[model samples]
Target: MTAQAVAATTRPRPARAWRAVLRLHQPALFLWGVFVTLVSAVLLWAYGPGGNAAGAAWRRKCTVDLCDWEDYSVDRYHFAFRFSEAAIDFMPILVAAWAGAMLIGRELENGTAELAWTQSVGPVRWLATKLTVPAALLTAGTTLLVGLHRLVFDTQQVPKGWNWSDNGTFEANGPVAIAFPLLALALGALSGLIARRALPGLIGGILANATATTLIGLAGPHLVPWKISVGDLKQGYEAPSGAIYGGEGAVTSTGAHIPDPCSGGEKACLAAHDIVGFYSEYHPSSQFWPLQLTETALILTVTALAVAAAFTLLRRRTA
Candidate 1:
């Protein structure tokens, strides 16, 4: 073979060429991304600075009672509702799911993989180049999301968003967090190599991603070593659903009164029973790193396994 031909066979194209691959997949990514931002905007707008109708009602009721004054802050409400965590949780899976379906599988379905492989590049290099764009874009998008979340939480007067307990950090680290969509992308890529059809690729990608997302979200904390505890009601105050004790002159059996604390009298101190100003025995803020590291490890492990499996499958098969 000519030296030029030999060089072409041995060396992969510049990674910058992968931009074409990323551009091809942008539409799929955009469609799924809307949901992530939509949910966040709705939740923040609803329960943000002036959005707490529900929280306000509960606080007002406490004013009539003798228990303690209820402090209502957007950050507290955001943490209570877990909106930021949900945004982080959903984005990766959605992105990966669509990519898996349309990018790898669809190309295979159209019998384009063979053509792609038969080009100047070999199968592996072609696949790598295709993946390069998506991977970079995914990393950029997620990092931006994390930054936005940090900005929102830190700028707020109340410390409401991005609690260590809510699984917010894990969502940003796509490689570690059972990120089903990313796995689906790999799976679909492999399947496209093996199955070679658009419909099947789409079906397989959707099913795999959906199932994995559900299973991971349900079983992740337990199957892996988890340091954060969710339902510890005994230590200080437990209100998962925002279960307020006192409101607007109404009294609970606990004799919990709300406004008595702010009533400008010594009576408020005595009435502030079961107020949620103390720490839970299993508080997450104090032990954030252990949980973060463990969960991050779990996610990265799963991602690595999936990528390995996909690579193995691709190596033996034609795309």
Candidate 2:
């Protein structure tokens, strides 16, 4: 081919490939856009107007001596915060379903993937295109949402009954927010490749994501070594903000013992346990990045493994 012809063909190949992918997934892309827009609006409202109103009302009614309990706006903002948090928590499952059912599984089940293989694009290239395009979009969209979420969460005064260390809060406030979605995409692709059916793949992918998230949450405290603090119960000790308490127990001259919640009295409880002081093991606020990065690395490793498995499965089936 002539130089102009060759250049024209090569340039159009990538453009055409991208256009095709976008066209095929228009519905998914539209929904993703809608989701991002709604979430962004919610976060902005929470930080700007909703939070301001709530804070103003709180300051008006609350004082050292007494506080009002009849305001409904407080409850409204609280529910808004909760709803925002729940949306963040559900992202992984949504990503998994989309990646599995819509991205690859349906194509494979309907024979569209095989037909695409007969075109200029081979199976490997097709799979790579499918994986990379959606992965990039998912990463960008989720990162944007996370940034907004952090802004809303950090700027607002936390409502009563909310803890920063809550599971959804911890995940949404850090790098795990981005990593988990990537992991879900990889897992969903693998599930789709294995099941070769949209519905089955979607279900399997959701289960995989759920299992992984639960395991990580359970192991989060132990992922990084925690700090320990000891203090005399009589003297009183307070944990720092954002501390994840592993456990609190009695420390005595003889040995350590489990804490007792006795209704009788502090003296009676201490005497029964031979406890002289209290000790706590915890991960503090300073450990947040360390813990978040460690968890991100772990989830990314699993994502890599899943992606590798998917490619292997594709090669096998095509062969």
Candidate 3:
């Protein structure tokens, strides 16, 4: 064999950073796999047996004005759906906690991350690997769960399910679920990088993500243009079916929207304000995907910022 060929054969292979990250976080991966499996099973059950049984029970037992509370089938299916949805919704925050405590913080706290840095992997590459691998997995898993959730919800219909405006339902219905968990992961990374200890990172991750989430939730309805519906004062105001109510008020001749002059429906008060018509601003159900995607975009934007900050912090610390 030639010397070059012998040297090439003898050369050590570069370490697989991603594989190391995976092996280190194997327990988390296993837990997530179990969670996804159970949630998928629950959702599938809801989509098939649970949905059919509830629908039939409702029709037979209490299809009238009032539903019978006796049959456990309705309650069982309802609880399962609710519980499953809640779990899916909570998974992101849980991801945040895990990412902060285990993924980044624990490594740094134990000097393992620094030890890895002394190896061939640079800090930037290490942080990037730490983020991207989990992010891809999280996004794919959450997206599937969201799809299953929507399927079950569509099959069950209303009363059994919820309106699009419903809090957890709305979030779980779209890319928001996928994006927000990435955001949570990013926030957790930032927290871990900042705290450099597992316990503090976990707490900081949860609080930071919670704050960001609350802000996002508060701003969700206004992310897209609100459909303004106007009607003559003589006729009461009405929004489209399955609309997310923004606010309602009196519309004057100048087209100015103002709060209700008489909330109690007092005729004299309505006349005193020169209320020519009533106006309501809402988002129709047709805008579901638009609103969802917009919110996803917003959350992803924040996630990008968090990840950038984490990188910047690491760079400065290493430098």
Candidate 4:
């Protein structure tokens, strides 16, 4: 073979393969760009201009006194925060549908994947390239958004309704934001490989993502053991901010019981019900990192299993 021919034959192909994957999904890429831009703009506005206006309004209305709510801008700021949070919650479904239908299922359904197999790329490399490129893009975008959200959330003084312990707030504020999308991508790829049809794969992927998120939410608190705090009812002990409230009840002679309607003062109520004090089980703010890391590990484990299953199915189909 000539020098030019030998050089061409020996050159690397992974870059070209990745470029082809990007080229194949240009529309999805464009949409992702639009989403990231819009989200960043909203967060920036909330952190700078919107937050300033709301703060000014609050100070002007309340000068060591309860503020009248006639013209305060707190509600507007709250709306922006709530809207951003809703967008973060919705991103996983989008990732799942696009990864399943556009990235893999359509190729298989239309025989383009088979055509690509005849080219320089093998089946495994092709699948890996597809998953890797999109995963990288998704991780970068989501991490940026999560950082921006934390900035805005931390700087602003929102009402109790925007508590960090809320489900959406907790997920969006931590590493779980990034992990969820990765998990959805893997689940979508696996669903696409199994279904081998575009529409069904898209539907299956969304449903699978929903089911996984729901299960995590239902089981997350149990994953890490919670702490119990006991205090006298007369003293009035309250859980710290950002603590996840498990349950609260009075400790009575008959064991722990939820407080019922007891008449009279604290001493009278205690005497009437044989209640000693109040005790509650909760996950405190100190547990945030542990819970976040535990959930992220669980999600990433599921993601790894899905990716493995996808590869196994691909190999069997093409063998």
Which candidate gets the maximum lDDT versus the true structure? 3
Number of residue pairs clashing in candidate 4, backbone atoms closer than 3 angstroms, sequence gap of 3 or more or interchain: 0
Winner on lDDT (1 vs 3): 3
Error of 1 at 127 (Å): 1.5
Model 1: residues with Cα > 4 Å off, grouped in runs: 1-16, 29-85, 158-163, 167-181, 191-194, 214-283
State the TM-score for model 2.
0.85
Best first by TM-score, ranked: 3, 4, 2, 1
lDDT of each: 0.52, 0.81, 0.88, 0.84
**How displaced is residue 202 in candidate 4, in Å?**
0.7
lDDT of 2 by residue, 196-250 (tens): 9999989989999899888877787788987877777665444666678887666
Error of 4 at 311 (Å): 1.0
* Candidate 3 residue-wise lDDT at 310: 97
Q: Compared with the true structure, what per-residue lDDT tens digits does model 4 show for residues 135-220?
A: 99999999999999999888876433567788788898999999999999999998889888888889989999999989987778
Q: How do the residues 1-319 of candidate 3 rate in per-residue lDDT, one tens digit apiece? A: 9999999889688779989988999999999999999999998988888878887888776754678577777777887788887997898889899989999999999999999999889999999999999998998888789889989887773264467777788888888888988999999999999999999999999999999999998898889999999988667797887778898898877889888878627778777888788988999888898899899899999999999999999999999
lDDT of 1 by residue, 223-315 (tens): 433232222223323323311121222222354434323323243543454332322123234333454455456555665676677667777
Tell me the lDDT of candidate 2.
0.81
For model 4, the stretches where C-alpha displacement exceeds 4 angstroms are 1-15, 62-72, 158-160, 231-242, 247-278
